[model samples]
Target: MNPETAKPATAAEHFFDRELSWLEFNDRVLQEALDARTPLVERLKFVAIFSSNLDEFFMVRISGLIERERAGAAGSAPAGMAPSQQLDAIRTHLARQTALQHRLFDGELRELMKQHGILLLDYAALDEPQRGALEAHFSGQVFPVLTPLSVDAGHPFPQMSNLSLNLAVIVEDPVNGLRKFARIKVPDTLPRFVALPQGPDQAGWTGVPLEQLIAGNLARLFPGMIVRGHHMFRITRDADFTVREDEAEDLMLAIEEEVGKRHLDGFVCRLEIERSMPAELRESLMEELEVSSRDVYEFDGLLNLRDLFYFLSLPLPELKDMPWTPVVPAPFQAAPDESGEPRATLFDAIKRGDVLVHHPYHSFAATVQEFITQAAHDPQVLAIKLTLYRTSGDSPIVRALIAAAAARKQVVALIELKARFDEENNIAWANRLEDAGAHVVYGVVGLKTHTKIALVVRKEEEALRRYVHVGTGNYNPKTANLYTDLGLLSCRDDLVADVGDLFNYLTGYSRQDAYRKLLVAPLTLRRRMYELITREMEHARSGAGGHIVAKMNALVDPEMIRHLYEASRAGVRIELVVRGICCLRPGVPGLSENIRVISVVGRYLEHSRIFRFKNGGADEYYIGSADWMTRNLDHRVEAVTPVEDAAAVHHLEQVLAFLLNDNRHAWDLQSDGRYLQRQPAEGEPERAAQALLMEGARLGEF
Candidate 1:
């Protein structure tokens, strides 16, 4: 284990390929759709999630690998995988997973939907009446949007936008008997699934794929030509682009320009065509798109299952998961005062004790939103400062900040304009905030401000007091109902001071490198994490019994993985609940036998980052906006705070314990990089961590 003796090739054995690990995570998402126990409509949601996830994977990860390959980049991955090698691995893995997804939808889900009186009928399967209705609808609604671009000597090839689904059509001119090729982009503005009128036999809804409707009515567009054949196709472009923040005069303008260019300028990373597509057409597509065979994926059933999300709007409550509303935490819930009025505000509640709110389980509207809304209107509040990584389009948090700014309260918003795919939205938000008189900063020059922390300075009695809310997710209310996240509200002196200092470092040129209580990334997080792991190792070596449990979205940093391995070798029991992209190999005899890794993929996305160290029986817990990824630790600005409140610490401990014991949704990772979904033993009760958490939330457990 000597660092001097270690070779890069040997070190590769201890980790899995980052790209392949991600594909495996997507495969786990596919597994959710494949699981029969999941509700019918919920399964469709998972299929959509899987498709959406793969789209991003191609746009960002696959595109990056292709770029590296084109530049002839050497093996720079910690797993010692060359760019070309990773690309090949992704192609092979993704093809298999995508095929499985298609089969599940086409073979099983469609049939299941039919039984539930919901029909996803093809054009050929439609009855005369249904066809007549669709024809009328298509002529009136869809024909106006259709623009068929021809590929001829005079026309040249059309530029396909990223993730645009289209129909590759072949037509013959009867006069000359010449075959012509044209592409009709399916309008994204229209619904992908065209709903059919309810029939006598079908109690629920019936819908046809929009592409099928377009394909069936091709002759309407080509009046004189004979429609030979038509096949569906989709293209995924390289959406990953970097804005040179250091060189640009205005970071927002640079990002806006980059965002505009990304759609039209990026190279084709993947081409998805229907399996029935002719060889000549496929070859022509490959040639015109400048994509190799490795980049092409042929699908049998559907081009984009992401459109399955459309069916979720159907009013079939029995076919979906039981909806649960998030409850307001007891601390935030209003109580009757002596005069029969509502009791103290959120500020007063936080001042009483640290309040931890878990999203989706804890009402975001009643907690985080209420906090900001109150701050905006609070007469005593002096200033509001926060960082925006990603938020919803109609974000209440942004509006509150704008309100605070309008009220003449000093408002500083560090909006990250480079949050990948969200650049345009973030840019729009930045502009809106700026126009509303809020001071908007585009974050650090070379680093992204990813910390999800907010500071509100208010005059309490006489002195000014700083209250902070640090979280593991964005302040997006829409996602708050979807993603499981944690946020801590406190007026703790040391924590508030650290957050103030962090904001100063972000908004102004404060060369701050240290903090009292919080772990700020790129300066203290990496070093402190290593020290924590080493301390656990020391504890285990001294026979004090060491244990560490951490949960995050991903675990990708090599040094962090190595530290975990070292801790495992030192006899520290390391349990990691990484939801995606785990590079570290666990349970190796000598290297990491003491390490156990599990991933939980279920109803809600596991997004919160929780780190717990036994600390020789004196448990130390932390929750923050960081994963073990290098980007999170050394590249982005992050903050991790100690959960000093005994109640919050206990709640986190319970969460970790539930995840570890979860049988229904947990997937255990083996040393050989394979994951096996856990199941309850005979006579054992079914245990799903998310479901349990929801029940606990309803019962006011935390």
Candidate 2:
């Protein structure tokens, strides 16, 4: 093991800490909460979103790192930091964020809400009548559902569920004079915030925390015990579990069992307790939970701020952002005839040429949903195939498949059961689809099927034709309104044939090494992407135009980052619009000076992945679900389809340009691993990509 014989440092040395970078992205969300320009209710919703995001981060990312640290695993991540060091840094940063969160909720937000008559009152702050009413409400609505467990020689501490807020009460046995710890889990069935009756002539809402009411009435639960202290706490558990797809006898059962374990048996990753909790009590709970001091957080405000969604959902219009209805792309809407009757169908629109649909701005219901609904009812349609990773709870897409199957049309569905936290929902949908007589596949072994595609085969005239929809997002209409994604509807021979082949590869054992028009992951997507990058590099070297633009949710693959670095050195002007977890360092003096990266975090999530390559002025564009992450590139079964139609290509370019030029709600990544907000310069007009898209959709401009 000579020092000289050590392996050379690779491009990974230039990568940023991915976990830290993700935390930075969450901080940007926090900035949205802190921004006064955001509607007050939306600001609160952002805070809740930030909390929920952090909880998941801890469950998956931090928990994995902690396990590695405990196992004495050696070596640094791509960011070049050891697991223990990353944990330390995470704790420091999270402490700052927690402090800021409490400051916002307890300070400015509280005063503002008070002025609007939305009082977050504590049990002690309630008047006698209000307190009495709450006591009555607790007795009727909460007490029966509560379970109190004692921690002692006779009774070991109860297993705490993940992320459930609980009250740790110290009660003294009156006769024996013995002190004991009791735990009461706040029922998830009950609302986190309980509404109270408005005062005479009152106009706004007032509420009390269910925990505060329960804590105040502990004496009623244990009539003979003397309550001494009560403190609130929550625990986050490890949720990263993978099915052994190769060994699994049933993928569905494995996923179902794993999802169950997520709630009942995950290793504790972090413990959050009230800051005022006694040191001894805190240590006791920590010891019982088997968590380290570094994993503990002391919060002064309400724990589990994700519960703030309760307040965010209030019917206070003035406190929320104005609603804008998603519009159908103008091309999809039929023009009125002389009789004032619309005649065009979604199929007719796609038949004209490839149609590009931008979601949240363009209506998903009118395009994707209509595509499936029409196919289901159309007498000419013979079969329907779709890959569903995650969809809305009440999915119209799934219903359409069920109807098509019931109608004796061949319906094949590849439902991914291991869609992270959406496993249970996906499993339910898969079961229902199976029950409805549809042929359902649980994706491929060892790899998650993440490609968003739907193929409809129809008997048109004298021939069977295929209509394909390839998208950069899931078929979930609910998310379509919250996540910015791109979808292409096309019926071209080659593209539809490729989509048909893709469905075959996903459903049956038809393995094609090369697709006609798709870049299928774990087979051709990664190789094709590398080849494209190399082509751009060659163009740059030959003094031809070498320009590249890619927009994605994340970019963390070591090889891709290195290739981009090489292309930059070869004089390629690379612009990356990454919404989260960008590891590549941009603007380095001589290393990555030609690469520029910007992230836009606005009202809608930028979830689409678009790649553009200017190969000697022959422009090429692609849109799909795969990001540049290693999982997306090398592990998952993904699909990226080329945008061949001139009009569709132009639409993609317009989107990329709008996002790149966005000064509002956009942050630029610096070489120093920091994100600086991109604001309009003096005398420059402000531009927010999402807002502009909304306006464009209103005017039917796209």
Candidate 3:
């Protein structure tokens, strides 16, 4: 009955469908919306996130499958499903998720929010005065930006932008008595919901859907034609194009051209239309978009519920979750003397020992950003090297890099131009860094340099010591407040040497095969991971209580899953806290009986990756940016540094324990790929991981 003794099953039987697992993850997000315990506005936020996440899923994942299916390359995925099979499953699951999204929004959250005085009035429900006011607002603000394109013999079907909401009108030529189709793209510059001015009887601010307002006054746009019927529809196009870096003369230009092309010419992946659209009109739209019934979603309410984010951020504090401000870790905070200004800086603290930062709980500004800023101004700091995958528009990290370069310090910034949707932003940063006298590398030839690491070389009294900041998330200060990530500010000699070599391999042609204190992907990480798992199995077989715990965004790598299964069979207790996609079929009798997987979705995104191994009481832990996915382990540059510092190891252990013990926001993955929501046992108190972390942050305990 042991996992080691159980016969090995086929790949298909052992793994869950990847696309379906992703849909299940999104469903978990939707479950947050269905929960009445969640705050009203926060529930709305989850709905918006669900919609946004699904849109991206289709754009990249579904579109890739469609392309493969078209090219006759419908190969089986790691989970043993062909592209066609996965597509069919995705269509069914996504349809259900979409339907549930609308039901939660229109049937529940909308009414609940209205009762809280945030009125979302439909055009049909508006009074004459309110209608007139909205019409005036539309005429002045929205009318000038509107451009209506006619589709007839004289005019071709207009090129539609990806994810743009538009009104498809069936206009009748009054003189000729012929019906035609025309499109009016809702201005992306305008808000999806416009707030109307408060009237004498209006209790709270009433808002009108922007599309509804435009639909009500359609006659004004097409002055001579009779407006027969109009319905809202949105197009989601394939935005997951890769720049042929090998064939490209300039990677930046290639990425930019691809980005622009996706706006106009990307293949349509989804066509979401209003359910009230006539059957004939819907058919015509599907034909024009070149998408069949499989890709069409007829929503009963809003087409793009992602616009609900606007209302989620409204100043309705009573209906929202309490605001959380990230606290400064005790190590990062300065210790003021009697004069109140005689404290040591972040650099001084790092010089003493390693400082571990748990973000959204610990302030990134006080640690990561401060580290870069101080390095830029310090005269002794000679050079800086960092890898930038994705960051904010007004990124303080980018600004600091520019300052460091301007100060005549040797600065190398490897900007990954293919960070999925952030190509343009990275391009802008690369240009800014180049203009500011920094050497910019557009990543490696084929792989994305995704390691979140920054190395600073300082000419100290002892020697030219290296200071490193390696993290599990982007260096962007904005996301640091929203994503739960871990970072270590260390000056450890071995760790520093590994980080320097990593930067060298990223920037130059020098490639080292192994690292001392860090496990790097595509070279040492995978082999080291196997060794770690094998060591755990050996320990368990030798009568030592073997324990393995890991937390990542996903766990889809087949080799790693197989290792975990083998370890499970060997009596090792394997615990995984994956936030998103997980293909491992845990809790399968005799196969994965020793393994347990849990997912935590809460206020802060669980973005950090942690790996722990109880190596016969010689405990080892690592934290970094690599997830247990093939792309991260074999196709991208990643770094995972050992937590040699006892305090940092304790912090990671606490985090893993909190995530595994969570009841309110955790979902357990089953052998059949279905997730069961974890609930508190009778008489057991409820515990939310994010809340516990927040409380710990307030107390400066984590």
Using all chains and alpha carbons, the TM-scores for the candidates as numbered come to 0.98, 0.97, 0.98
lDDT value, candidate 3, whole model: 0.89
User: Largest lDDT belongs to which candidate?
Assistant: 1
lDDT string for model 3 (1-702, tens) is 856568774467888877888888889898888999999988989999998998899889999999988887755756767787878888888778788889889999889988888888889888898888888998899999999999988999899999999999999989999998899999889999999997687565579889999999999999998999999999999988877889999888988998889887889999999999999989988988899899898889878888889976577887788988888888767878999894787778888889899988888887898899989988999999988988999998889989999999999998999998898899999999999999999767889889999999999797898899999999888898889999999998899999988888888887788889999988899999999999999999999988999999999988889888888888999999999999899988877988999999888889999999999999999999999999999999999989888788888878888888999999999888889998999999999988988998898786
Cα-based lDDT at residue 602, candidate 2: 88
TM-score-better candidate, 1 vs 2? 1
lDDT (Cα, tens digit) per residue for candidate 1, span 1-702: 642233332478888988889988988998999999999999999999999999998889889988889999998768999999888888878888888899899899999999998888889998898899999999999999999999999999998899999999999999999999999999999999899876577579888989899999999999999999998899999998887777898888888888898887899999999999989999999998999999999999888889889988989999999998999998878787899988789998999999999999999999999999999999999999999999999999999999999999999999998898898899899889999999998777889889999999999889999999999999999999999999999999999999999999998899999899999999999999999999998999899988999999999998888888777777899999999999999887778878899999999999999999999999999999999999999999999999989889878988998999999999999999999999999999999999999999999988
Arranged by TM-score with the best first, the candidates are 3, 1, 2
- Global lDDT for candidate 1? 0.91
lDDT of 2 by residue, 133-191 (tens): 88889989999999999989989889888888999999999899999999999998999
- The per-candidate count of clashes, in order, stands at 0, 0, 0
Q: Pick the winner on lDDT between candidates 1 and 2.
A: 1
**Stretches of candidate 2 above 4 Å error?**
1-12, 336-341
